[model samples]
Target: MVIALPDPPLLEPRVLGVEDFATKRGRKYGTVLVNAESHGVVDLLPGREKELVAS
Candidate 1:
């Protein structure tokens, strides 16, 4: 018999660190959102407008 383990729950961050940078060609922009407590990258948004990053 085989048993499957349940997936771990996701962590919710109270504080987020956001960073924005441009591609080498300067044609696209990328944004990174990190969890302050864990210091882990939570999300990455590429080729997105500045407004989206701010929001």
Candidate 2:
């Protein structure tokens, strides 16, 4: 008999911490979650565009 493996858990949208954001953005840059105060969600723009900003 063969056993079946369960599927991986789906990723929920949320504000990424410093390290996580950097990895996802593919660069070491400063980025503050737009909803850092409340929902803490950081939804990337369409096409995964990167933006530079001065802190």
Candidate 3:
């Protein structure tokens, strides 16, 4: 049997942290969103493309 867990809820924040880091080191990159106020991780994106970050 297999089980999956739901992701944590995201709430409106006064301070947010957005960071893009290289995965494969220059070959690939990803984005990370954090709720800076509570110092909790919000979400991670597959790529750090400019269009992806804008939305």
The candidate maximizing TM-score is 3
Query: Which regions of candidate 3 are displaced past 4 Å?
Result: 1-10
Q: Write the per-residue lDDT of candidate 1 for residues 1-55, one digit (tens) a residue.
A: 2357675577899999988888988878888999999898889987467677776
TM-score to true structure, per model: 0.66, 0.20, 0.69
Model 3 poorest 10 in a row by lDDT: 1-10
Best by lDDT: 3
lDDT value, candidate 2, whole model: 0.42
What ranking of all candidate models by TM-score puts the best one first? 3, 1, 2
lDDT of 2 by residue, 4-27 (tens): 777556455454432224554555
Which candidate would rank higher by TM-score, 1 or 3?
Answer: 3
Clashing residue pairs, backbone N/CA/C < 3 A, model 3: none
Candidate order by lDDT, decreasing, is: 3, 1, 2
- The C-alpha lDDT values of all candidates are 0.83, 0.42, 0.83
Residue range 3-48, candidate 3, lDDT tens digits: 4767567578788799999967689989998988898877888899
Off by over 4 Å in 1: 1-8, 48-51
In model 3, what lDDT does residue 24 have?
70
Candidate 1 vs candidate 2: the lDDT winner is 1
